[model samples]
Target: MPKGVYLRRAGRFAWLAFAGALLATPVYAQKRTATPQKAVQQQPAALTIPSDPDDAFVALREAARKNDADRAAAISATLVDYPIPSYVEYFRIKSQMFDSSGQPLIDTPDAEISAFLQRYQGEAIADRMRNDWLLVLGKKRDWANFDVQYPQFVLKDDTQVECYALLSRALKGQNVAADARAMLVDPRYYGDGCVDLISYMAQSQQIQRGDVAFQARQALEQNYTTLAGKIAAALPDARVDGDSLATVVKMARNDPSQAAAYMGTISGNLSRDEQGAAWGVIGQFAAKKLMPEAAGYYRRQMDLGGNQWLSDESQEWRVRAALRQGDWKQVRQSIESMRPELRAKDPAWTYWYARALKADGRGSDAQQQFQSIAGQFNFYGQLASEELGNRITIPTRTTVSDAEAMAMRSRAGFTRAKKFYDLNLRFEGNREWNWELRGMNDRDLLAAAEYARKIELLDRTVNTSDRTKAEHDFTQRFPMPYRDIMQRATDDVGLDMAWAYGLIRQESRFIMNARSSAGAHGLMQVMPATAKYVARKIGMTDFSPSMMGDPNINIMLGTNYMSMVLTDLDSSWTLASAGYNAGPGRPKAWRTSLSRPVEGAIFAETIPFTETRNYVKNVLSNATYYAALMSGRPQSLKDRLGMVAPSAVTTTSLP
Candidate 1:
């Protein structure tokens, strides 16, 4: 979700409010039959219908949003000459696609949906209709129809849809266990479709009991007790039951030592995988708590059964625990013990593994690992560059010609995407935009990014430009909008303008009225309380949270807060960036918990909160690129990161 999407949604709701009076007396506004008055009014005339087609369409849009099929039908009936007949028809069709519970209406004919898909074949809504229909088909076990339509789902980003697709293939005697395993890591997204896939695969012997057990561990780790119970029931063996697994997982979460003891009591009755999984769970919780015993638990986990039973998460936590203890050998061993696919997927492991190699006098091997990831542009990639004795610099800019950019403006997909963006339907707009970029060459991508910038969609500009392989455009990727306002704010507090802009880019993608779900507002994503606190600190007694919507005010308050956080955290940009995202209290506590001085990358890796970890990495990496752009010189990400040392005393004075 975009930061400040709620603020944008508020604007969308304003349109809904405009038609609220008509909606108040909706044609289907009758209450339950238990109310005598409602029963009498059930057959009332359509007196509330608007004469204007636009107003009628808006009413229909609102009805569709509420999933009021009867009202939508009543309103859409009056939009006979609506300019956007596609949308008018779409709202009507969508209202009937699913019932109030969001399940596909079994009575809705597939022919009607197929007709809509054929009518608006390449449009975003048509694809959305197909997605809705596919779910209905999947639920009904109509794999024949699902197979015919699944290829047309343009985004294919929905996990449930992917699960269904995999399930469809599995029903046809195809081996999809590996693919299903990869997709089923996050139990939170495992709807009935994924659950069905796992159950079927388990029953048919396509997937071993270990696979189901692994999923059960994953479910328990996420506190999805019911899901864990369901998955555990799929295990063929009686020893691996839900109640026993949940008890150990719950114990591990609170006290790893207790869980370790509990595991010892049952070791004789459990399989090797079961024992390793329990130890892995204990180690994960212990490591996250920064417990000193975490390393030993991880060691025991490995000793029990090595990497085969360890989840990717467990292996990563093992590396984290080893890093915290400064055990280079353990770090190397833990990383090397990771599944080959997992090791290759994350560069953090590769970078740390390289460091471990260097620490052990394996210089040539370490150099190879660093060289493999150095050319990429990311947190680890930049660190690897520095390890290889190279400074971070911008790749040569790839210019998109005016003619190429203009050509993109005329493309149907781009136009439709722009329309959706204008309507604040960002999800649809982004899908529409990306759908057209699949086969584009590097030059074409640059052109689309430039066109995205022209449309003032800075987020799209950054994301699209970031996709290029052979060509690059830093300006588009790291745009500096509201430069004068941001510069003035930064200068007022002796702050780094590049760093402030980088934070804003990450915070809001330069969206002026961006708002986060946490109630942060504007380009800075400054929370209401933080804005007020900054307002008082700056002696702006008259300030209100609404002022955060203004770029100037948001930047002023945000920069001041950033400055305060930096000062409180000993002027360390790494700590300050972390403080900015997760609040000052967390980084302060994290620093105070450290046993010794650690490299900035290691400190970032060990951050307990996943969001803040990634946030700090991206913000600093962004700052490096911004610094390069502003200074017209090579910049060092390592210099920005510095070294994070333990603090004997910590304070949470900054909010």
Candidate 2:
């Protein structure tokens, strides 16, 4: 075959090969006329092969296979003319390269691979190609970089596990045993396999055989219980001996109240390790809900100094039980007894300690404790602040008479209902539309009515189908102070006022004292540590966690943090919203690594988290409606708040 002709032939063959078969196909011919006068001659109709791009590619494949260079070239040319469907483009590109005999090219240059990845960025094909490149690179150090950079790309198979294991071993050099154990515990590799693998390997003394038992033990402690029972069942038998059995019996006896029944039933003939495991099972059971039983076993294990390894685990269980039962005094004592190093590193402990202090009426001390944390404040601070009588404040933009507010509310109400009507029209066939409307009817109608009342208080008139009833309901539930705070914060942060209201609504449902499980506090759910940092930056001295409960402080800090996150994330509200819900660092990293700019809608849809995705939609939609209500003008919330440009004011001082 001619050198250049092979390329064309290869391209065509790729287009034709499909569904496990290579078939010969006839090529459509274009007719030509010698002159315009002679061109009156009739031509054959164009062959209407399947219009799908995949069919076109298959046709191209058949032509290349037959070494029909002209047909292949024509097909390749044709394929390029159509839209490259996301799925088949990879196969199409590969089929384009050919060797001298018109065979598909075997090896492609790294640069070509990189270029291909860039061209098809965000597609699954790009991920596969990138993984292949990383494997080819085969540098141990690069594996982590590759994993972190392309988490969505890595192949999840045995090969992936082995590759990570090898990389871990190589990185650890002299401590391959530890590395292997670590790899097995890593969520990416071991997943549910870690629990059984650790138990089995430990019983067999595999780490001891490799002179890395200590390191292996560390890995086992962190991940063993995370494995599922199904995977654990497949583990190798645990070695049990007489001495181990005796130790287990003794451990069981130490927590007599909890494990006494289990101890009585265990076979006396069992070896020491078997008894130990039996006791472990008893401990596990107690940990679930029978804390008394678990505590007994843990105490026995603690007394047996030889099993000091279980000390930390026992204490953790005890602490958990105490917290579960809301034993504030016990929680305080347990946290105080814990090593300062551990308490400092674990946010949970710190938060609980602060909570305990607050519950004990040491409010001042609790506030100080909450204030000390920088990044790790969680729900504890929120609870502490609320108990201390702190309420977030929203500053009013302008004083308006009740009549003015009522008039504004009427106008906004008309716009909102109409928008919903229009949206229903646009998405008449969409189930999601129906779902949204249903949800609005179930709950948001009341919230919207309340918002309308606030607008009405500002002398706004909202004309709608059920204006009288809505007005009555709104008047009953509307809180002027809260609405004022939301409006002021929105203006201060240069955010759309409606967006701020929407965020507050979704975050805390307008409950000034609401606290989330993740430690977000107040109406705006400002994290305590975040609040402290903002407070310090704003030159507020003697700042206390109690202040976070204050409406003004909460709004100020939450808005400031929102502004900071928005600035850091390229001003994209979608990413900023993600950061707000899931922390700023993760979304920022995701945004930086994305090869293609995500469309706002598609980005929200593709968000890996269900909570964050819904949050973005709710926040944006709420903002849109709020803006319509507040401004008395129909405008897109996304356009106004989607990407904020930095203001001329660079200082921390509030406007």
Candidate 3:
């Protein structure tokens, strides 16, 4: 063929081939692209699962949260081979042992619960289950099982369970009246188990009508009519139901000018003891409001019978009222009138009682009392130290040998505690650690703390050493972790490093990943929103939310925030510490309410919020010790506290 013709024929074949390829491209592309897209879409779920156990655990948790026992049982059944298998196994057993409602599967309760306790025996969950079982046994009034299980219940602090134990004792012809009376102080806290015990006591005449009426008065303090009614139901002639006591108490507290009317109302209708209690309530309200007339009211109640205002609550109010009015005579009288156990429980009252003696010209007796509590690491203890002309300084500690340390770890309690920590049950671990050391002498506890420190369980080390009554090991009590970062933060913000350390110790106990129920995070427990606001304010843009647990960023933000609060709080660490805990507004409000300058110790004791009150005292007291340790000299806690008084002006600005 000619060359041109051949070339044209080749071009024609090429066009045909190109057209064919174009026709095939979409199908080929669809086949290739669809495979990757489908896999990518599937990858999200698949990628989330690192392994079969992880995937199964995620599903198990979701089911557990929903209380979907059936699904959980199915998922957890095959997870027996996983690490931490006990937790997974619990889900399976829990599914059958508890219904979807979390109440025990009533039909099959006995053997499975026993098996669980026998299997998980010293584990935290076992005791928790025992708590549930005891409640169930008590509800059933199966006294034999309740007794059997009650002795094994390690967390005996459960008031309801305590009540149940009392109920069991009552079943055996024993009078639990004194125990019942002591625990009845907080009537508003009665749950079903406790209320049942109260009913049992009332039916057996173990709880008197007067006791019922007294508790009713306590209920009235909270405006908890339901609690009052519960008491009234148990004792028909108790006279609580007819008093409308909550109404009278609220009226007295909120509108004190009508206190006269309420006072008359109580005396008019209530029984003798109830009337005395009513007067005590009025005295409490009056005292808190700084009414000078409160002393006369308390005196009138005292005249009814010595036991009328004999309660811890009533007598504390008497002391507070006297303290408020500067009546040194009544301060002494009221302090002496307090129950011996009550006075011994709080050093503040002891310190003040000594001061009262000193004011009344009994110098020798005052010195003796102040010297007794002089070395305590608390607000009153520090104040008492100042009264004795001493400052809080580093304590001499007996060092532990390696053999002693090894022996401490070999102890059953320490070994059990380490196991619980390994399981990440910190509460259980700490409880076990402390529980085992309950009866140890000071040196043994220090040895135990050394063991905890050896294992890097820093919190237990501090806590164990803190339990000593006659010994003070400052190094063990306040170990400085992340000291370099903390120092940098203190330097940067011009804040006291000791104070910052003290706050962090209280806030998180130096747990790097500590979080609070209020969503605070890190060692200082700053809230995320607060952290971001702080970050923006200080030009701190070098971190993200994940860095909240970072020692540097957390310390930086915490110290800066603390510095801001310190300035706005008149440079008093007492007020600043309170502000850091509760908020800036509350401390300012609390100070402005003071009619005159008060001793810093008085200011701390008078804080309305119990949590904030304790937080302030503890932070300042801790800083005092830390200061002594850091500077190698005795530090004046009084200088740290200075004086808390009404602000010169109502300052509301905060950083």
Best candidate (score: TM-score): 1
lDDT of 1 at 95: 75
For every model shown, the clashing-pair count is 3, 65, 0
Off by over 4 Å in 2: 1-168, 176-206, 209-260, 263-281, 290-292, 295-318, 326-347, 356-368, 372-378, 387-389, 392-655
What does the lDDT come to for candidate 3? 0.72
Please say which candidate is ahead in lDDT: 2 or 3: 3
List candidate 3 segments past 4 Å from native: 1-76, 79-108, 118-126, 187-189, 223-225, 237-241, 256-261, 264-266, 285-300, 303-314, 401-425, 435-444, 454-456, 469-472, 541-545
- After the best TM-score superposition of candidate 3, give how far the Cα of residue 390 lies from its true spot, in angstroms: 2.6
The digit string of per-residue lDDT tens for model 1 on 1-655 reads 1224212334423423322422242221222223554344335463276777656766777777766677788888888776556778888878776665465555566787888889999776787778878877775556778889999898787788899899778756678988887777678888767776776677667788777877877877878877776666656552344456557788988888899888877878777767777888899999988887898998888888746656677888999999998999999999988878788888999999999999999999999999999989999999999999999999999898888987899887788778767766677678778877888999999999998888799998999999999899999999998889888889999999989988888888887767788898888899898898899989998998878777789889999999999999989999999999999988888887788898888888988888998899999999999999999999999989999999866667777
1-655: candidate 3 lDDT, tens digit per residue? 1224213334423434422432342211111123554455344443243247757765675565554555666678768777555556555555444444454333434687798889988876677678777765665455777788999998787777888799778756689988887776665556556665676566667777666666666666757777666656667564653555545566767765476466674566655655565566677777666566777777776666545324466678888777766678988988887777678888988899999999999999999999888877777888898898887877787677778877986676677668667656577567667767867998898888888888888888888889888776789898888899999889988999999988988898887777889899989999888788789889977757888978888999899999988888889898899988988888787666666888777777767666987898888888988888899988888888888877746555553
Cα deviation of 357, candidate 1, in Å: 2.0
- Per the 3 Å backbone cut-off, how many clashing residue pairs does candidate 3 have? 0
TM-score of each: 0.88, 0.34, 0.81
Error of 3 at 587 (Å): 2.1
Q: What is each predicted model's overall lDDT from 0 to 1?
A: 0.81, 0.46, 0.72
Where does candidate 3 have its weakest 10-residue lDDT segment? 25-34
* Candidate 2 residue-wise lDDT, 1-655, digit = tens: 1224212333422312320111121111112214553233222222333466556656755554553333445456657654333223444444334332333332434456667877866544565555544433332123444444445553444444344444433333323445454344233344312332333233334444222222232223333332322233222332223233333434443453435565665647653433444444345335533343454554443333223123243345545545444457866866776645456765556666887898899988887776664222122332233334542111122233555333433442244333433333222112112222232341233433444455332111111112232222322222234667766876877865565665775676555566778777887898778788888877889889888888988888888788877776667777677778877765654443233443354344334455985787667655554554555555443353343222233222211
